[model samples]
Target: MSAAETTTAKVPPTRPSTAQGAGGGTGGAGKPAVRRRAGGGAALPWTLLAPCLLVLLLVLGYPLARLVALSFQKFGQPQLWGFQEPESVGFANFTKILGDGEFWAVVVRTIVFAGGAVILTMVLGMLTALLLQRVSGWVKTLINIALVASWGMPIIVATAIFKWLFDTDYGVLNWLLSRLPGVDMVGHNWFASGPQGLAVIMLLVVWGAVPFVVITLSAGLTQVPKELEEAARLDGAGSWGVFRYVTLPVLKPIIVMLTTLSVIWDMGVFPQVFVMRNGHPEAEFQLLTTYSYDKAFVVNDYGGGSAIALVTVVLLLGVVAVYMRQMLKIGEVE
Candidate 1:
């Protein structure tokens, strides 16, 4: 208890570090809990998605791998039935498909058909969505019911209904058109010409596609700021100007997504064309899907058919890339 001892005695001893004490004398013990939480958070989404991924791999991945393999081999009836071993032909199938004038024609026709269908679908959908925004509540509800009903209709049933509507001999569409003064649509063969036939099919495609687009656009519309729209109008923006300057920028992402999906769906149109043409699509009526189908089943050129399908997949991947780029650009703008 001298001077130094007296000073030390008066001073209180420091307690052990609270962090270490709380962590049971191990300062870094809590780190593992944080790391585990981080890891678990990262893994949770993938764990949730694993079931869907497994199903897709089983359902779509196997067929896609088989298609890729078949495209490089001679896989006709003989090989298909095990009557003969398949011969590997390297790039022969791809070369033949790329060299074919008919294949190129089908490619161009498909692009045009899909382009038209997407354009019409977007225009009609946007107009309908805007109309919904203006209509009374009950009217809007009725329109929603109609849109959902059409969207829920099975593709086969809808195709059959369209077929009857455009039937050559007995169709309500023709009867209605004939009622127009100086118009002769009775007994008109709508499927006689390829473009005309494709146009009709395109209408059917648009009809099926528009409801989803309308619903999506309408939902997106609700997210747009009414204050921003009113501010623009007060600044002397007209209807078109307000939409162009305010509304369009806000909805650009949704519009890009809808357009891309519509393109993909329209390009892969098979059931509509196949069922409409009575399962035997004419040469003029051939899109890529139908052409590949005819090549595989009708002509028994499975390799060529697979090659065409793979090319189509490449084109669709390119479209998806465009959509991704657009979304990224929109994000940057925001």
Candidate 2:
């Protein structure tokens, strides 16, 4: 061997190529391109979600925009049926609805009715769900079947049936109550009094609503860890204490979701109340939804009606926002 060659270490000419392959097959300049690709891949899920957002914008956004514009414009019989253009009245419609004492009364009435329904539905649903969890076999099946049947019954149809049940002269309820000792419900005319009729309507709403709450609560209960519940019980907690402390914290999100939906549904309750107030459409029996319909369709005051609707939307948004905040706070705490 030549002395100069033998004195030097051997070097592979292709070592740089192998080094590049080992380091992710990307040279320094190619890294930015790779990173760009990774960024695109990360955004694929959101890209897929775009269609849902677009559909919502088209459906909800378009209607909401029209409603806001309509609230600012007085579109009465002339604009609606006479081919006349609507005139912009700015806040006048809002002021009119807001300044009316009767409108305020209706708003309060709707709020109270919805609140009552939500509370009753939640309490009853929770109790029913707890009971169902303990029951088994045919008893559970019968209970589930009954609740499902109630849920499947259409509100409009149920309202009609209830009207007959509470009828003044020949109602089965009146007859049954009259037969009871010291009870004088016969010929009582349940709908004759405004409060009495409203109370009945609230009960009907709760009856229709509870099944959904029951199903939701039951599903949440299934997700609760049995071991944790047993541990809580072994630690000397009673049923209520364990439920309040252990099960509830875990089910908080579901409870919030169910309550929000119930509140929103009850707030916009119409068919049940409308059917109850069918024959006698008195001002005292008006809910916010019914009152808006009355003003727009019956009285031909579209702008005033739209203003009331906007107010209702605002209240609904406020309630949903509160629930969203609670959910976020709970998530953070967890």
Highest lDDT among the candidates is held by which one? 1
lDDT for each residue of candidate 2 in 112-194, tens digit (9 for 90 to 100): 88999999999999999989999886987898889999999988888988888888998889999988899998788887777
**lDDT score at residue 47, model 2, on the 0-100 scale:** 99
Per-residue CA lDDT of model 1 for 72-190, tens digit only, reads: 99999999899999999999999999999999999999999999999999999999999899999999999999999999999999999999999989988999999999999988999
Q: After superposition, how far is residue 202 of candidate 2 from its true place, in Å?
A: 0.6
lDDT of each: 0.95, 0.89
Among these predictions, the greatest TM-score belongs to: 1
Candidate 2's TM-score reads: 0.89
> Residue 100 in candidate 2 has what lDDT?
95
The pairs that clash in candidate 2 are: none
